[model samples]
Target chain A: MINTILCIILAILMISIGGKRGIKSFISLCLNFILLIFTFYLIACGFNSVIVTLLGTIMFSYFILFYVNGRNIKTKISFVSVIIVLILLTFFISLITYISKISGFGEESLEEINMFSYNVNINMTNITVSLILISLIGAIVDASIAISSALYEVYENNPNLNRYELFISGMNIGKSILGTTTNTLLFAYLAEFMTLIVWFNGLNSSFSYIINSKVFASEFIKIILVNIGSITIIPITAILTANKLKNTKE
Target chain B: MSKFSIQRKDIVIFTIILILSTISLVFVNNNFKFYTSTIVKINSIEEEKIDPITEPNILGIEEDYYLQKITGTIMNGKDKGKIISLENERSTSNVVDEKYKKGDYVFVSGNDITGLKRDVYIIIVIVIFIFLLFIIGKFKGLLSIVSVVFNTIIFCIGIKLYTNGLNIILLILIESIIFTIISLILTNGVNKNTLSAIISVIASMLVLSIMILLIAGITKYKNVNFNGMSFLTVPPEAIFTAELLIGGLGAIMDVCITITSSIKELIDKDNNIETRALIKSSRNIGKDIMGTMINVLFFTYLSGCLPIFVLSLRNGVSLTNYIQANFSLELTRFLVGSIGIVLAIPISSLISIKFYKRGDAR
Candidate 1:
């Protein structure tokens, strides 16, 4: 019932925004949503989530960068490059972090194991790795895109600007957005776990005990690792875009 | 003034908030109905069970389960400072449950049986979080903390409303809007750029929610089984919608603000830049941001659902059944929220274009 009311409000907002563009945006998003569902269905069919995620990332890039941005080759190249770099970065980081071993820290639903049939053999470790990889993809993509697009704009606005100048411009934009983007991640984590935090407070757990708790330790490590991944993307995207744009212009 | 002056001011503010928060903590602890207990001594330890299948432990003392008799002093409540005895259950799989040693403090209810062992830990974690935020973000950090407090209050109210039999979806939607407005205004201040971001955020949420409702309706809501969540009393659909609304709000707002502020910068750089060009620039920016924004939503949802994923997979559940039973809700949220993010790019860009074009014309 509330969904119907919100849809009405959305319709009014979309129409006011410009019926054509608004409708187009809505359709594009719907299609993207469908693609995501399709990816999961493929995973359910025994396909690897890592590969499915990569393919989905490629399709999503095509949709948002190429289709939505009117088939701009420059934007497409920048986005795809950043995604490639991000995937590589995540691979090496995950290897060193040993993030998978600790991934099973917060399984509160273990008591319900008997509820489901357990005949099929599935690799829990691989799935955990894939889950972490999938999680990092969003932040990496956001950072890379932010840097690449800002640099792209710098290049577009000033055809005569050199590589160094564009790189600096991208860095400046990145530095400003970094705080908020990181906060966005922080708050996102906090919002999800507020109740857990409240429960902890109600229990009056000490700081040492709280940090040592399996659930808290796991989430804390994830937040830190993701922040590192995001911060790394900024310079990599900036340099890559600067280099790409420089070569393209020449 | 200088940077040092600002640092000093921040430190002062942090100290004040810390004091106030500590005072409130004491007030809550004293006022609330809690049975406080402290560890006194270990009475005895006995092996209970090594394996459920085997009735006798042929291996003897090396058995898996151990029951410890822990005697403690009641620090508060009707049995204030009285000696008490409790059993602490320890298992080989310590990951599932913890064993408290001597000198530990715990909070027990009226029955004095079910008690939380580490109640003070969370308060320390929160204090550290606030301190770090203030040290890093300074004034903006302070404002972010305020915004978080407001959001928590609003969330509590929404939960109260839901429990009281109010329309959960409506409450969530209203809560989300209020949260977005307050967060934006606090973070970015009241300005044209913030307004554009706000509109974009609302538009994205609306689009995502509508699509989800349509899809849910079409599928007859088969995949959304909320039976697994033992705590839920309302319809699973409402809870699911509420989760999506709250889960997607942060990333959507993040994307919208990035696009809006970036476009605003471009316009300020060149006042006469055409609306067509401005819109193109914003879309380009959106493309760069879309992957990470979507991933942010994806990761947040994934992390929360990881335990269930692991539990199901470890139990040798079939991939298809696991996906159906455990992952459908998370997948719906991540995808629908991703769509909102994707749409927010264009919506924010277009809104900024209109705002900028009008400002330039005037």
Candidate 2:
């Protein structure tokens, strides 16, 4: 309660100083709060991993991308592509979970869970996959948006351009964005856990196992999925949606 | 007469596929966590030298480090804030941080910018600068500020309400709505434009939500492993179904804003633009945005997980242990959020199309 009051006061103060930007910041704060709750709700419901994963993703799309703002292709496309990726990425997750057998967060987590009286299915491998995937979601979306917007702006400016021309334009834009976008995700992942990565370096571990092992392999698969999901969908979805919407008008 | 109508068959087919995918995701996710063993290790002993500069942190970072010259405020340590020398650490660097001294008051943790040998302040000064910039930007900044703070509070309270155990879907549904309203109100202001955007975002979020739940149920992925998440507070990713929840949160907002803004802009561009033409044009816009939007999520999630992989290359954590001890949060964030980004593209486009066409036909 006190924190809420403080938040309110601070928000008002920011509004006085910054106005619109301050308002945005304040909204971000609230949206994050609701997102946090939705997360908990999933956990509280006996660990239904699949449901939670899906719920979390949609909630993220709604809050982070749209903030339920005005109608724009920017928001709509993001939601659609994100959901589709959610469905498609399952293949990699399943494969990772199957090989890891580190279900319910490995032996350490299982031991703890055994002590509890919860009915939730605690699969460490699956749960860990969730975290890895979540982290990648942000950069992937950002990159996708940047590419799509750049392409459409081009097409909008040059409506006389042929479909082939438009697609080429999109690919050209996509290529430039791709390099940094990939780096962005890669760096973001590394930065967030640089210390832990450093810790892993000091540990007595193997290269082959690190690459092929469930943890490494799973994350590897996830990163690949995110990369592919973001980069792949941007052009294809953009083109198709553009084409369909275009054909309809003509 | 029914010229604007979507083909019933197409809608049915799309809906079926969506529902099926949702079911599949659930089944796959539930029973698939009992296999892999791998851990990426790290080893390092290199130091790079950069110019020394005093940095400060006030907000928007992982660790608890704020701006203060401790000359008068150092509770325990000796070299409080007295012209301390900066150290040379890692990825972080020292830049002119005027906000701490000039403005208000921030950490990535450790002496990333400063060395450990001498007292060093962890640098989230960049983030603090960002916060200061927000305060300086005024109204627009205030709106953003409102969003940041507002979202944080909603997240916390929502967590409590969920823990106390409310109707699960209701918690999500209500929060989504409130989130939409607040976001629009804050960013676009109280107007017709804001109202329209709010509606589109809500609609798009809802459809995507249905797809996610459907897939989770079908896939039956067991979501266990909720403990000892390495983070500043609680690893929201690991708590509850955090991976999916937070994973999808940012993307949802991204899509909502895009779709609404595009539609509003198109409508504003030419109020007489026919409904069909408006939808098509915006969708073309969506295509461009979708590509980049998807990548945004990719970077956000994948970047968060990169450190482990890099460290693995540097040191030698066992593959088995690396995946086991780590990799949960990062991987999930990527996949789920990516999925949401994909789904959002079509849903928002479709809704917006219907919306503008309605206005045009009238």
Candidate 3:
């Protein structure tokens, strides 16, 4: 019921945004959703989570940037920069996941697992790691596109701006985006777990005890780790775009 | 000091509130009582055999599990600073039950002996999180922390009302509106930009709720399962709707602020710019942001569903069954929230255009 209503509403809103552009955005988002579900299916079918995630990230980066901005140099730059960041961030995400001992912290699902009554032979740790990695991709892609386009505009408006000036402009734009993006990520976790927090409080759990809970720690680590990726992309994308734009101008 | 030189006062007020809250949090006695125990030594470990008749396993036999004889010192309560011995069972699955080691802090209950409660690791993590936030955000970070504290109080009150049999949806709606206004004011101050963002958020929510209602009515609200969310007290549908409202608010607010502030900047830069040009530029900016803002909603909502997804897949459930059983709520939220963001772009753009034009008219 909600899906149908959402689809209709999205269709109307998309058309209103721009007849063709709106439709394109709607289709692109739908495809992205399908790709996500497909990625999970692949993972379940015994494909490696990391490889599937890499391929999925590349596909999503292309689809979102191309669909939104089209086949411009700006789109290409954002795509390449995002991929580079994703490659570098994957190792970091894995290291953090392993060190934190956050794998299989699904104690909340103990009841459901009992109800299902199935043999648990899967690597619960790998799924946890994959989910964390998957979560970072969206933020990284978003940051890359925002910085690349903002820098592109800065360079466009000021034709004579050199590489250094353009890079500085990109950094300034990135700095502004940092706070809200971080909040978006943090609040996202908060919103999902608001009830759990309330439950803990009602039970008289101390702030220390609540934060140290497996569920809470898993989420907190995920938020910080993903934000680290989002933050790193800013400098890397800025330098890459600045270099690209400068070279193209020459 | 000028009238606007209120930063020092704000800091002073914030500090006092922080100190008071911290003291109250630590010193106040909780309604439920627990014995604080400090692990002194792991005395011994032994394998306990379970009766095959009582406990059956996949191999048609009971599995042996380890039990540790743990000795600890009571740090608080009537047995303050007293040594005690407890058996820590190492269960077959470590996810459900945990094993304790020497020098670890644990909580225990019961008057006679004691039942083991959770460890005290979360407190350390919270301390680190707050310290990092303050160090990175400075004054702004301080304000954000204050806003979070206030918001949490509101949410707790809202939950209290709900458990007391108040309407959860209404409580959540009111709480969300209040949270939006208060947090924005605290962070951005009272201004035209804040007003525009607030208006945009409320307007988008109104439209989104109408869509939800229509959809709920049409579909008769089937497939809305609350099986996995066994923790909720109220009706599952009510909690789900309330969560949807609260879950979408942050992303929508973020979008609204970005669009409003960006458009405000453009209008300020060129006051004589045509309305058509302003709207067009706003749409362009919205296009640039819509992808990631929507992704923010998508990823965040999906993260919560990851556990369920893993559980279902591990159980060898089919894709369709997984979607029906696990992904339904998250899928609804992601779609509804994404649509809210989609609507927010134009809602914020159009409203800011009006606000700017009205300001110029004055």
- How does each model score on TM-score? 0.65, 0.42, 0.80
Model 1 TM-score (B-chain only): 0.85
TM-score of chain B of 2: 0.57
In order, the B-chain TM-scores come to: 0.85, 0.57, 0.81
Query: B284 in model 3: Cα distance from truth in Å?
Result: 3.1
Model 2: share of real contacts kept: 0.09
TM-score, prediction 3: 0.80
* Model-by-model DockQ, in order: 0.12, 0.06, 0.26
Model 1 docking tier (incorrect/acceptable/medium/high)? incorrect
Q: Model 3 scores what on Cα lDDT?
A: 0.68
**Predictions ranked by TM-score, top down?**
3, 1, 2
Using TM-score as the measure, which candidate wins? Answer: 3
Give, for candidate 1 chain B, the lowest lDDT window spanning 10 residues.
B54-63
lDDT at position B296, candidate 3: 65
Model 2 Cα displacement at B225 (Å)? 6.3
> What are the chain A TM-scores of the candidates, in order?
0.80, 0.72, 0.92
lDDT of each: 0.60, 0.45, 0.68
